[model samples]
Target: MARLFNRTTQQGSRTSLPMATTLPMTLFMALQSRKTRYRSTLVVLAVLLCLSTYLLARSSSSASHTLLHKDMPSDDQMPVVFEEASHSHVSGTARKHRKVHKDREQVTLDPSQELAAISSFLASLPQNVIPLSVDPSVTVDPQLVLDFDTRSPRAAAEVQHMVADVWLRNPVFLYSKLYSPASREVKAMLAKMDLRPAPTIIDVDIRDDAEVLEPIIKRLSSSSDLPVLLIGGKPVGSMKEIRLLDKSGELRKLVAASGAVVDGSKKKQHKH
Candidate 1:
């Protein structure tokens, strides 16, 4: 009985030692688990802080970019907008200039058209009558004198008619010698007068009366020159002198002073 009791006690002591060892191991394990949980929590908090900082930095950068863009003009819009504005201004100016040019053209007369109208009016006159005529006694101006031979009556009549038509003044015709050598000079003078605007002419054929012209020829110092031009009873040179006066614009004033209507349209046509 004593031996059984000692063995049982030893067994009970062994069981108690095992229980204490188990309690220490369980406590160490619980502390380790708590430390691991704390470390995990700290890691999670650090990660969250880093993510929040990153997000804040990104948001600030985005906001700064947006503000920079809003404060300045866009590169794409600057040139296009300004160019369109400039073009509009230039176009408006050009249109105004074009309008002025068009108005000027509308008001200005065409030179060719005016000339044509004047020509049409002149062409519609009677065959034998002059365009305009004035009586010599009505005005105190000079009378244009012409001496002609009537041997060729047709030629002499034609010259008289031309002088009447062009000068717009009546001419006096005088019958002169038909057989004289001076008659050839009279024919030559008539030929020259036909080519130009005629003047007031006085025709004198000496063949009708030699006694009437002998003293007049001697006074003129004309020798054999049968055709003579006299202005205001004084001998003016010839057809050449008349042509020079007309070319120098003196003829218009001279004729106008004598109550002759000098047509400017005719003068321009003669120049052309």
Candidate 2:
């Protein structure tokens, strides 16, 4: 009976040892499977993070490129606009200068036309306005005398003393042929002015005294013209220069300086 009890206890101990070994193996396998699942989850999270970073970087680059393009003007359009503005400014400046030049040209006068106008004015004078001859008997101021060549045509002689009354109250010496359209115009201009004394007229024949007349005319003018005004024993210029001086108000001062009396009242009247 004792032997039977000992055999039964040994069989139970062997069965308990097998059960403990199997439990430890099963627990180790379960731990290994849990570690594998954790590794797979970490790999999937890393991939998602990398994809998200790439997408964010691409979007940022695209936005920067769009902003750059929007801020700057196109190369072709910019140059064309600037060039057109520059050309328009230059053309406007050039046109202004041309207009100013044209205005200056319009105010200028022709020399020939001025001379023709003077001639026309002389032809319109009244026929009855004849200059009186200078009398040798009267004592006259030599400075006031306007000398003329006697050899000129009779028409030239008629106009020599026309302005003598107004320009000089003393006397005018006429050589034959001293009359001309210029002289007539000068005389008519003088006659229109208020003067004190009518100028005395004297006629001298150049044929009789050519030697005396030649020196006088040469001293007064470069050419042997019909009429020459001598003031203070000096030549004043031709009719054109006289007209210029008169218009400028310089002739009155010059004549007054030469001991010729100008009508102050007439000058004031003309100014008004």
Candidate 3:
């Protein structure tokens, strides 16, 4: 009975050693599986982060491109708009210049037209307007002699006599101011031309009654300019009119009509 019991105990010891080794091997395998699962989870998270960043960058680039394209104008339309703006600016500037040019043109008159207008106005006056002159040497104040409508009955009689004096002279009278540039120009032009009867220049500014004489001259010529011309007791015009008439050869004709020979030396040839 003792020998059988010993054999049974020996077999149990060998089986128990094998079971303890198996338990340690099983625990090591389970730990290695858990580590592999954690590594896999980290790899998946890294890949997802990289993919989301790429997508976000692409979307932002596309949005920026869209905004830039929408704000910018097309190349074809730029020149047309620029030209329209330029034309508008030029037209406004030209309009202002044309208005100024038109005003200047209206103020300057033609010689023939001015002469005809003055002649018509003079002929329309009453026949008994100017009576016979009094004394040729009498010195009458211009204010008293020219005041036909404003002054007393004696003033009207004096104006009539003065008008008669001016009418009877039949002179080429030039009513001018001393310091006027237009008057100087007219005088220079006349000096060059050969006229039979010399032009009579009246410098109103140098007169004793300058203020009084100036208005009277203006009323007679119906102009607010100096250097008014008169041919055979008829009002001719100013500097501009004379210049135009001279250019057209009408100045010589008018002078001849007024009984004044122009360039008489040229007409008379020297004997050979």
TM-score of each: 0.29, 0.29, 0.38
Q: Give one digit per residue, the lDDT tens place, for model 1 in 1-272.
A: 99999999999999999999999999999999999999999999999999999999999999999999898886533322211112221232111111111111122112222222211212222121111232321221111111121122233353444443432332211123456454445444434333223333333342222343343443333334445433222333444664576567664455445443345456658889
lDDT of 1: 0.40
- Computed on alpha carbons, the lDDT of every model, listed in order, comes to 0.40, 0.43, 0.55
lDDT of 2 by residue, 11-100 (tens): 999999999999989999999999999999999999999999999999999999999999888653232221121222123211111111
For all candidates, what are the clash counts? Answer: 13, 11, 0
Question: How well is each residue in 1-272 modelled by candidate 3, as lDDT tens digits?
Answer: 88999998999999899999999999999999999999999999999999999999999999999999999876542222211212221232111111111111122213332233222222333121111232212322222122122223243354445444553343466778899988898777666566656676667787644564465556656766788877766667756788998788787687778765566556555422
Residue 98 in candidate 2, Cα distance off native in Å: 74
- lDDT at 246, model 1: 53
What's the best-to-worst order under lDDT? Answer: 3, 2, 1
Tell how far residue 66 is off in model 3, in angstroms. Answer: 99
Is 2 or 3 the stronger prediction by lDDT? 3
